[model samples]
Target: MFLTGEMLIGQQSVTGSSAPISAINPATGERLEPVYLGGSEAEVERAATLAWQAFDAFRETTLSQRAEFLNAIAIEIEALGDVLVERIIAETGLPRARVEGERARTCMQLRLFAEVVSRGDWLDVRVEPALPDRQPLPRLDMRLRQIPLGPVAVFGASNFPLAFSVAGGDTASALASGCPVIVKAHSSHPGTSELVGRAVQKAAAQCSMPEGVFSVLFGSGREVGAKLVAHKFIKAVGFTGSFSGGTALMNIAQARKEPIPVYAEMSSSNPVFLLQGALSTRSAALAETFVTTLNNCAGQFCTSPGLLIAEKGALLSSFVESASAFMNESSTNTMLTPGIYEAYEKGLSLLNDNPNVRRLAQAKESDLPNQCRGSLFSVGAKDFIQDESLHEEVFGSAAIIVECDNFEEMVLVAESLEGQLTATIQADESDLGVAKHLMPTLERKAGRLLVNGWPPGLEVNHATVHGGPFPATSDSRTTSVGSAAITRFLRPVCYQSVPDMLLPDALQQSNPLMLKRLYNGDWEV
Candidate 1:
């Protein structure tokens, strides 16, 4: 299918003539095809109305039916082929291989959620038998089961246009949980979003699902996204972007007539500490690996290791020199968008102008437009602790190595750090004492901890936590990836003294869904 600029609302193709948005190639500063228009407040109202109409039927769908619907979406996305991949690269300025890889990942996660839906573990059912002979008053029969919240609003991410965008984790988990979704397409990649949004619409029709099961709107966050969050029909929101944007949405949700949850993945430096033993033995290799991860996708990843903590010594100095050489010599890479490129420049200038910050390595400027050359800088632990600007994320191919006086000072630095999505400790068996000492602090500091490995590689599994406290994410009580994400769009309902005929299948006496449940004090048979 060809890429259309029209927004996908229910079963209709909507063209918003009021306001328009278009994609631009960051590498060449050229505007691509498909000038997408923004939907009006009336359009947002229509989508939410349809979703409310479909909510009851969609939420009551059988596990097998919902699982099949999710699987159909994955198949439809796979069929998009080169049409989807090319548009993503054109809009994002990323390499073809990376775009292709992201496409496959998007499909893989959708299908994975299909399997999870079939498994039915997210329902979290509980049963308690009725009692008639207990004390003066008999205990009543009781049962509890999880149900889908109302429609969900997702804000597509500019970084991972595929994996974290239109049909990414948030949408997949929300759909799998039987909640209708309305995605606010990122202005940076409207064409790509339009294509994926159509694929989802096609799959919903093929599966004979409700008409308003999914929708995608094109516009800036201010006009379209803010309207969607404030709409009373929307029960929850999911976002992945900057701290200011996330916090803004969070405040909007909280200030609503009826407050709803907003799960936003925001800023994280993902600090990495170089232990004495590991730096002494493998400083060269560690430096190389650090530079490689820091420059991946122009360092657009949320898990990029932006901070390095190490003690002041010749070993640490060698690591810095090796890392600087590796970074400065690396080839120039195209960033996601021109705005991000300009922001990266401003961030670098902020650090450069700071008196306490020292520039260690500066990559040669590239001849290409919007090309981000790698850079490395250094600062003392005391300076870093005192200056709040040092803790802010640069969002590109840049990192700062903080050299401390000793392990105690490094511990103090770690304690004073902000929340992170990931924190790593590169150490050997000989450095177990310091590693143990830092484990507790690191555990409290980040959602995920690593040893002797880079942090950019995120796994889509049950145990993975692609979230953190405070600025890392809005709600640390839940996650935005993995099977756990389904819970974000779900709420519990308890039935008291209800007849089997009246109870939902998941909570009925027959155990019709065959789902695992907690009965009294025992697990389901």
Candidate 2:
């Protein structure tokens, strides 16, 4: 069933008693369906009231029960994997392999959070008792525990519909944290969103969750999103999108009478610095890797290295020539959505028309349906540094080769970068000597640091930081792609002078939660 723009309350899609808007499929450039626009003042209040009702019981539910619900959700998502993949391919024009991988990632993310909940230890609480005889004097027992922050608003991302949309990390993590979620479906892939939404609803029913514990709202208007962010019931927000859109929501959240946290993973122009020694020794290998990095997934990844700073010389010229040739020979590709396609063209046009920029190679249009070719551009390091627009992200199979005169010029270019999700250093033995100087500078400019490697394959582990500063993400301290994602859904709450019986299971000495924790300066389980 096509999911219309209606407020999902309990297990039903209740159309708001008002006008609505249509959600389109970008691949076909067709109107798939219309979603009911949410009603004004009274409707917002009603939605909030339902969420509050659900929260009271949902928050109090046992962790084991919550785990069952989350696990069920994961299973349901897996069962519908094929259906989800097909819809995603049709709506977003993503290759089948790519869609399958995203589906796996989505299911993995859900199961990961479920395991985190099943262990019941992510909420690990710590306690320290004070002795009256001690020199520090008698003190009350201090305890720490993580608690949910009420209802959350999740903005669906257009790029990775399954992994970042309804039933995605935001919804799974929030639900795992005992917080209800309201997802604003991305217009680009609403059909895929609805399929996943149905799976979530199925899981909620099987696990007997509260009626309003999760709601999926659909609309195509800016006002719909503006109202959702401004709603008093939304205690927090999760966004993954462009800088302008993310920042706009943040401003609205801040303007609230009582401000809420808005976790927005914005845009990034991840940079790569190729040292002279490395470029001189491994020009061909570096060129191939650079081509793969820039053209991977049509360069739609957030960590795509948009800028390349190489020392000015014959080595640099060779690297540029090989990379340009590789991109030209690569197949033309379809974008995730038409909106993205338009943006990519516009960004490319802007860079191409700039007087300082020069086209290195261009792809010829192919007969393949829905496939658009891409081109490569370059400019001198001095010119790149002087032009602010050169730094913007051009989301497609494109790369900018910046030729630098020497190590000093390379460092200057590195220093000029805005916050990024990652920055890679292609260095050899001799380059390592200089790397000591460049690594620190690069670390300050990005969240993740790579050496002689690519940044596209994100590992969802404890050490991975999928977020960065400013344009890379609104907050560098949190990540949205790994187990660390739990941090986004949790806030610490201290239990002061409460009796052991009154203390949360997470904090009790008996260790009922059985989660990994630090106790008396040692790991405990």
Candidate 3:
């Protein structure tokens, strides 16, 4: 497979008319080959028009057929092989092992959604027979089932090029739920996005899917994305990026004459709470694990632990000493892009200039371009509570420790924090009372509450939730990962007094799909 620097718009490889964008190797600061041309409103119109045309036919596809299409996408991605791996490494400067792991995760999630589709649980079908009784006015027959919202617009993320890019979770879940997709590829990894986009295009062809089922667009600035979000045919959106980008999309979607839902995952400073009992017994071990989690992938993950809260004492001092030792030994890593590296440096400077914040430890400096050195800082609990700047995400490997005077202050710190993707508690059996006290506050602040675990290792399973309240995600009721993610692209519709033959397969009287459904106020398997 070769890179062509063309946009895939419904089985057509069209050249763009806007300014071209190229990928640069962040590790060595070298330009990559084959610059990709940017798209304009005309391209957006073409893609959205095709997507709307294919929606009715694609949404009516059988369960087995749609599931097979998803599985075919996974197979096609795996077939890309080393070509995909090398391109991803060059584009994002991530290590080969990490890239390989992300590729596996990407395929696993696609297959997982395939299985979810085959099970037919996402339909949530229900039926109620007509009652022609004489006691009261006769009731008409009514049936209900969830249906896919129209076309969707997905914005790729810069950090995870494979698992969260052109054919990532948003695309997989949206397709599984029977919605056509139009992707706005991230500018930082155009070559990688093109490779994956071609694979998806091939899969649609091999599976005999609609021609306009999926399309990929490239844009260097906000023009293409804004046009896609504001288009009348795009019924919903799935975004993963900065707060400014996500909020901008949300505002555009809401301003439309027919407003749409934007499931945008923006920012999170996933906080970790260190309890007294666990810290006293395993301070050294806990410090080692904390630093390890903090430095993983240069702390580029959305779920990275950015804030730590603990009571002030010798136990806390020992934990700090051990953590500082590990931080000093940590190696510098190349970031995803030059712009990301610059933003990280500016964030460090802000903390350095603050009067209440004191630097605790920092890794050795490196002369390499786009390098990130792990850093740790500390501030009093009162200062953290009063300063809102301490709660913002830095998007790199930097963490803050809030030293509290007592348990009450620790609770107050947790209460003062903003919404997060995760909140972790390091506790022992004796610390259950303290952990119990903090549970309600954490439950309100974070989407996923962890006991004795880190937050970076996200699992692609049924029960896992990769979303949260407010800035963590635009809508708290939905998740952007796991089996439940399909619900984000679906809406319930009810049929009243419709004849049996005129109903959809899932809502028919014969129960053709063998799905677990609510029948006449009773559950039937």
Candidate 4:
């Protein structure tokens, strides 16, 4: 694999003819080579056309073949090893250890999806036998199975460069679901993107997969990406970014001549609820854990706890003191990029200027460029309930504590929140009654609920859901993480009165893959 700043398009190396784009080291504000040419609309068209051309063949591959191809991608990525990790660290301003861990996660998840493919459960095959002499007319033989939704356009993420980028969950899941993928590399990390993109290309070639099964492009402006989204051949989209960016893609997809699905994991101000009992028992410990989780990655994670709801009391005061002590001693950490740092500063300013909000804590200094200082704010429940601005996600190490007067006020505060990726409830046996009361509301407001723990790191597995209702994501029905993420790029298809000879393998009676499936109106795994 080589870094040529050339886009990979269906086994072809395309050097863009538009303006050049380069990766920048966020920590030092220095630009790094190779300077990638900005991709044009024509390139996007070419990729989409090729992907659609390849889809029929690619999607028809046996499960073992697709699984092996995914495994090959993981192996190729591992082969890159240190080069990949170091480049990601410099490009994203993340630490060496953190970058290494992310790279490992990237490979781990790819292999996980490979296992999912081999298992064949994703086909979701169901069958019903014909009842030729039934009372209400004979029920025709019918079989149901899932099929790929064709080519997918994935927008690499800025935060998790590897796990959510060129070969990230979006790409991995799309590929696993048998969709040819076209990735628009995030501008902040083109070098890293190129490396990983090349690894995928090598894997596809090595595994004898069709060309255009995976393509990566570099775009300097929104036109290149928007063009990809609006293309008629792209059947679905996968994105992880800002609300504006995600919605832009969603609107383009919806307005298309043939509308497509857009699975966009957007912003979230994950809220944490501290019940009276939990706060009374260990407010100090809770505060300590909150500060630590709040400061992780300088609070860039989508699941980072950004708001707190609690009733005003001595315990709440003690918690604030503990949090304040930690904030005072906290040192500024370098953020992902200058744009993000600037946005964070503006968010902090919004909190600082709000008349109803009081500053709860602030770090002493922001001594370096692109460094983010931790801050906390507090406001009365009445103001939080009234001001919609308070609900907007700040996207950094900043949070607001809503002080409610009583249980009813706390419930009101909970009811006022917008959709989130996660919502936490810190409770004990004594608070279970109120906690139970809050469940219905919380379930409606969030995709994942937590008990006695802050939301931060997400586990990538079969049951994990890294999605929520808007503005957390464009569609709440599908997740953008874990094994279930594959469903987003697949659609259920039913075959009726089709002979066994013509039936899709998964729907055939023999069950060649030996997968558990519904048979004769009985449920199966």
Task: Give the number of the best model, judged by lDDT.
Answer: 3
User: How far off is residue 320 in model 4, in Å?
Assistant: 0.7
Reference-based lDDT, each prediction? 0.90, 0.79, 0.94, 0.91
lDDT per residue for candidate 4 within 473-493, as digits (tens), equals: 989988888999999999999
Error of 1 at 60 (Å): 0.6
Candidate 1 lDDT over residue span 1-525, tens digit each? 776789999888999855778899998889988788898898899899899889999999988899998888889889999998888889999999999888888888898899999999898999988889989988889898889999999999999998998999999999999899999999999999998999999999988889988999887648788899999999999999989899999999999989999999999999999999999898899999889888888999999889999999999989989998988788878999988999999999998999989999867788888888778999999999999899999999889999999999999999989888999999999998879999999888889899988898688888888888788988877888888889999999899999899999888888988888899869985
Candidate closer to the true structure by lDDT (higher is better), 2 or 4: 4
Q: Which ranges of candidate 1 are over 4 A from the true structure? A: none
Q: Candidate 3, residues 242-312: lDDT per residue as tens digits?
A: 99999999999999999999999999999999999999899999999999999988899999999999999
Clashing pairs in 2: 5-35, 5-36
What is the Cα-based lDDT of residue 71 in candidate 1?
88
lDDT of 2 by residue, 1-525 (tens): 455656665577766664455545544666655454644545555556677779868987888889889888888878885767877887787888988888888888888887777776667666665445766667666778888888888989987898888888888888888998888778777667778888888889999999888877766656667787888888889998888899999999999998998989888878888887898888988888778767666788888788888887888888888888877787777777767878888888898789889988866676644454667788999888888899888877777888888888888898888889999988899888888888878888888999989888787665778888778888888888777777787888887777889986778778776666666556776
Cα TM-score of candidate 3 = 0.99
Judge candidate 3 against the unseen true structure and give its global Cα lDDT, from 0 to 1: 0.94
List the candidate numbers ranked by lDDT, top first.
3, 4, 1, 2
Error of 4 at 473 (Å): 1.1
Better of 1 and 3 by lDDT: 3
What is the alpha-carbon lDDT of model 2 when measured against the actual structure? 0.79
